[model samples]
Target: MTDWAHHRFTANDLLLDRQLVDSRGMMAGRIDDLELSDPEPDPAGGGSAARAPVLTALLCGPIAYGPRLGGRLGTWWAATGRRLRGDGDGYPCRIPLSLVARVDRMQVRLTSPRELLPSYRLRAWVADKVIAPLPGSGR
Candidate 1:
């Protein structure tokens, strides 16, 4: 059987909605978007693993993905994301290939969890200001 068949992922699976976590294993965010490069290369004499091909990057958050989703709506979405963030160019968090440990049915496990991640401002803001104030925030 093909390796992918053994792994069992269908192409049509919803990748965008998946949650991303930190190395210490806290919920970071969802997989807001993906980035890809041209398939041809190897001029630089870099090595590769025998069993797996290298991934260029894993992108998360609105700014990193906004441009890929083109047109005026994309622009609007990007701008709004920046405003909500309060400042900055709004680049999506880039997870390097080296940090990934494995991909199971529901989530991508990372070799380095939590130690390298920062607190997610938006999540905290929403939780503290909105959800936590509600009757069942902890539950």
Candidate 2:
């Protein structure tokens, strides 16, 4: 179990697309992007040197995923997400970095259960707008 807070890591090398597992070991989702704290003066007291942004959260789902695709398809997908969200921001579900307990070759483990994560909002929306409208689905 790597202590992510103290370790130096490249987000793209270790995090993107990694499987996410909740405390109970249930599959939560894949990491689509990472959120970093705005750069700040180094806590180590380096006079004017700015510290690299620290990882703050994990972003998941289609809205975050689109940027990683990078090109015409990515642009179209992200725009579609913003249109669907209708809120302009279109930020995907964000799981705080504090919840992350471990990271390995293929997975990023969370200390809390998936129920505590906001990743389900998209699923709920789809159920309401798409699934519930199906002929056999009982609303």
Candidate 3:
């Protein structure tokens, strides 16, 4: 691995679609979207020192991936994700930036294990409900 260093990054160019590996070297997921920190409100209301929005979290799962896929398929994918989640809030699996230990060209490494992430439950559910019963799945 190359020496990790902080550098200016383009979200779309550098982050989008990058695979995420957990601390235990497990595949977590690919970065599908980002949640940015809202800039702090200026106390003076003068708009002179408005803080720039910063990255807050990395998002994954079909809910975050659908839009990027675009068109009808993307729409359907997102809808299906929301349906499976069974929630009105519809937020995807959020991996906070604080958990990210390293970011390289091919993957973003996390300080936590994949099983520690909420996405793990979703994947487990899919495996149990969708995949296990399929023919030749060998589950």
RMSD of each: 6.6, 4.8, 4.2
Best by lDDT: 3
Residue 19 shift from truth in candidate 1, angstroms: 4.8
lDDT of 3 by residue, 32-113 (tens): 9999865575676544345777788889999999999999999999999889887666898899888888887778898988
Q: Relative to the true structure, how large is the alpha-carbon lDDT of every model?
A: 0.59, 0.80, 0.83
User: How does model 1 fare in lDDT?
Assistant: 0.59
Candidate 3 to truth, TM: 0.79
By the TM-score metric, which is better: model 1 or model 2?
2
Where does candidate 1 stray beyond 4 Å? 1-28, 32-56, 104-106, 111-119
Candidate 1 local lDDT, 1-139, one digit each (tens): 1012134453236345566655567766666566554345557866444434434556765665577578887788777777777757576667665665555456656666544643256666777898988896784
Clash count, predicted structure 1: 7
Q: Residue 12 deviation, candidate 2, in Å?
A: 3.7
lDDT of 2 by residue, 1-139 (tens): 3355436677776798889999999898899988877457558856453456667889997789888899989988878876777667778778988889988776899999887887766667777999999999987
lDDT for 109 (candidate 1)? 60
State how far residue 33 of model 2 sits from its true place (Å): 1.5
